[model samples]
Target chain A: MVNKENKFNDIVTDNGKRIRRICSYYSPNHEDRKDMYQDILVNIWKSLDSFRGDASINTWIYRIAVNTSLGFTGKAFKQMQMIVDVDTENLSLLFDEGTKEKLEQEAQLNQLQIELNQMSVIDKSLMSLMLEGLSMREIADVIGITEPNVKVKIHRIKEQLKSKLSGGKHE
Target chain B: MNNSKISQDTNGMGSFIDKLKREDNNLQKIFKILKITYIVLLIIYIPIFYFEIEKGGLFQVVKVVFIALGFSTFLFVFAYAQKKIKKISYAEPTLILLKKTEKRYRPFHLLDLASIPPILFLAIGLGLSEKTFLATKEFFSSDLNLSTYLVEARQFLFSGEHWFKMLAKTVNEFPMIIVFMVTGMLIFIFVISFVAGYLLWVSKYKPIRDNALELIKEIEN
Candidate 1:
């Protein structure tokens, strides 16, 4: 029992760091990142008891973490109801000589987070794992989709991201 | 509205979930402490009651009765504490603030009324046992017929005792019996009130409660 608990804790520890890093990519503040991280941890712990070993432990943990993060993001959206509609012309007016580079980077990251949030939970999971450098087959196995489906998802995601990035550039 | 907007929404979600996990952990700790204290008190008290009964003989029933009431009151207070803990677990602190803002009050929801009947039966059983003991005392003291003993017992209780000395003893002893009845009645009424309040909250005010729960989940999330 102790050994099993230790193993579980190790999994959570590794997965938690990944979750935090993934969450920080989107969340701006300490509190929001912490909340997202805890949400991932709690979901992982809750789902642990039902984790059959058919999929690798790594795959199972990542699946729960991604799904939980997506839910957290959705709930936050509903709670805040904050939507930024940046005007393309106004963007130039908002930037200053001193903060121009910093503002651009922050804006780009925010735009990317928003685009990811709008995607389906599964799509978000697929894209996030792909971002983590997992093979398409591994991503498919983790998300319970076929490799061909993973390929299709990645293709669509790339298109979506490109359009979003282009829209951000226009703004 | 679009992808970038959705991303900003999810960014805030992480913080809400962390707060909820911490709160749940704290509540679970409090629950464990209460359960441990209850078990410890029960172990210490049960033996003391048995020792008192053995030393004082059965006629020292007054002491036994007082001890029983004390133990029971202690138990009732514990039960009340447990009920409170259960409610606090379900009742999110954030939702209470929301209710105050909405000017809507939450009625107390009670547990099952079936818990009352067993306690009521126990109280009645104790009263009957008291009657039997009184009849035995009369049989020894006055050689009164069993039926006569029954009449005297009823009269002494309902009509008040005629003999000054007997009246004092009856007054002293019968109050314990009355205590049992009063507590039993209070328990019965409380149980009934609990059922009524819960039903009213569930049927008439479900949406309000649901909204409260949602607000709580939102705050926690």
Candidate 2:
């Protein structure tokens, strides 16, 4: 029998990118993001034996991710600790390869992240997965919603984003 | 943005990933320690309880206490195991998901499962018991020729000695004893309630273990 440690490794190895994506949503600061990530890993490790292979691997992981993120937010909120707010400039530097036009692009991504934060959790997850290149079907399965519902929700979310961007003078 | 910029974005994300990995290791260590400590405690206490059952007298009380502890441990283990199993099985994910939602928090409902019915029954039972005691005495006095019983009962009804005259025709019987027991029980229940209410007010239900299951799930999720 593959022991728990090996099983835990298999999960992290397979879902590393997905886990990091979820962590990024909850983490505002570098340290907090790290702590939240650790908490998620801990929770996943503790709960792994309970995963009965009924749901697809992705859905099970998403459930744990969502639950852990909520737990992290609740604890941080109690400490009145804000998530590590992404520095738009630093984030821009990471993506902007020192080009003059990079400033404009960085500003857009920062605004996007901010606007994304304003969206509901489901909306955020949907958009984040879409940005990660996940298919609508995969996203729907992870969220336990139908594909049609996913499309509808995505369309509505996009409309909301459009209004927010226009109103805020996204430049 | 060019592909090179996308590459850098991914690189920065990669650095954060390493940090997450380190954090996971630390959490694993903490959980392992906790699990080991609890297991060790169980190992030591189980044997102590086993011997306590053989000591007799005061040890009997100790044995019962240990048995209660053992039973409670079993309950906790069972609950923990089921929670683990349910988490894996996806028995009711929607309910779990709903419980995880923030707007539907219902902390006190958990307590209702165990506390509500018994509390209502206790109040009703005590009330009916007191009434029956009174009605029985009245019926015996009026319907039956229990004049002697009543004369004996009247003596027990009121407090402070009001002795019967030397030639007093005593009708009170031991019927009042039943009334006194009922009244005493009612008083005891009332006192307990008053004390409990006061403590609840003062403590605000410190360490409220049950009835917050949904709330905790909601908040944590």
Candidate 3:
């Protein structure tokens, strides 16, 4: 039991930063990202018992992280509908800084995060996994999609991001 | 409209996040209140059910047993929902947690639907038993004795003079009128409970299951 605890702790210590990055990539806000990170850690600890040698510990952890992030977004959307009456489109206008000025002020990564927020849950998971530097095979395993699908999706996501970052006026 | 255009506009994102955080906090508070209310109602209901069972006859006892089973199923769903709510971490990805939460509560929908029939049975059974007891008491206490009352009731029912007249005469002349009145009451209660329970389940619990399933598919695809 003590050995198991030690191993869990070692995994957390080694991969905690990467896990936090993944959480941040999927969650648009700081509070949500913090919650996602904690949830991922707790999930990892809880699911340790079921960890067989079927997959590497890294793949397993990635799977948990990706799935947890996706679940969180779905939950948030539902809760938002129940408790908040604000129209999302109208809410966007209230904070709109115009495309040009806003681009100049925000960091590139923050811009990336904002763009990610607009995606479907599946797309968000795929992009975040790609951003985390997971290989296509690893991403495919975590996402339960084919490696070819992952490559196609990643290429499309990059093109979309590039076009979005360059502004609609083209480079 | 496009991603880059939206990204450049970060001001809305901050306020949006803040609004969501506030809403999430309020949602948690509401859930806590609902949990407490359920516990309180359960506490109040159990003793009342026990008393009813103790005072009731065989039909009453059977009715109470079915009602108790119905309540128990609801309690199981409530307890399971409470447990899942406790396990949820607000800091995590809300979508994923929401999906799991929905999945956890899905079985309760079927349980909710199943509980309706037992409750309808309870209402019918209770009405019939109590009315039968009252009719029996009335027969024994009336000026006419049991044999005389039975003879008059049989004549009133079969005399076949216009059905409404027979009903009216039965009401005036027969001791079994009380039984007929009670049977009417039983049908009324059964219909009301069946309609109300079905409507409540359809409007409330069914949506929870549907929303969860929709979210799961959205996330998986």
User: Residue-pair clashes per candidate, as listed?
Assistant: 10, 20, 20
Candidate rank order under DockQ:
2, 3, 1
Worst 10 residues of 3 chain A by lDDT: A80-89
Clashes by residue pair, model 1: A35-B14, A35-B15, A36-B14, A73-B10, A113-B7, A114-B3, A114-B4, A114-B7, A115-B3, B16-B221
Q: After superposition, how far is residue B205 of candidate 1 from its true place, in Å?
A: 14
In CAPRI terms, where does candidate 3 land?
incorrect
Per-candidate interface DockQ score: 0.03, 0.11, 0.06
> What is candidate 3's lDDT per residue for B30-112, written digit by digit as tens?
77887788778768877876887788667657766766665666566666656655564423333455555576555345545
**Is candidate 1 or 3 superior in lDDT?**
3
Rank the candidate models, highest TM-score first. Answer: 2, 3, 1
Candidate 2 off by > 4 Å:
A75-104, A167-171, B1-96, B100-221
Candidate 3: which stretches are off by over 4 Å? A1-11, A26-32, A46-55, A74-121, A165-171, B1-108, B117-130, B133-221
Least accurate 10 contiguous residues by lDDT in model 1 chain B: B88-97
- Cα lDDT of model 3 by residue, A1-171, tens digit: 455556666666678777876765554466777777766665665566567657777777888887666556555543221110121122222122464344444474356445555555666666656655678898877766678877787776667766776565333
Give the per-residue Cα lDDT of candidate 3 at B202.
79
Instruction: Looking only at chain A, give the TM-score of model 3 against the true structure.
Output: 0.72
Best by TM-score: 2
Task: Give residue A40's lDDT in candidate 2 (0 to 100).
Answer: 62
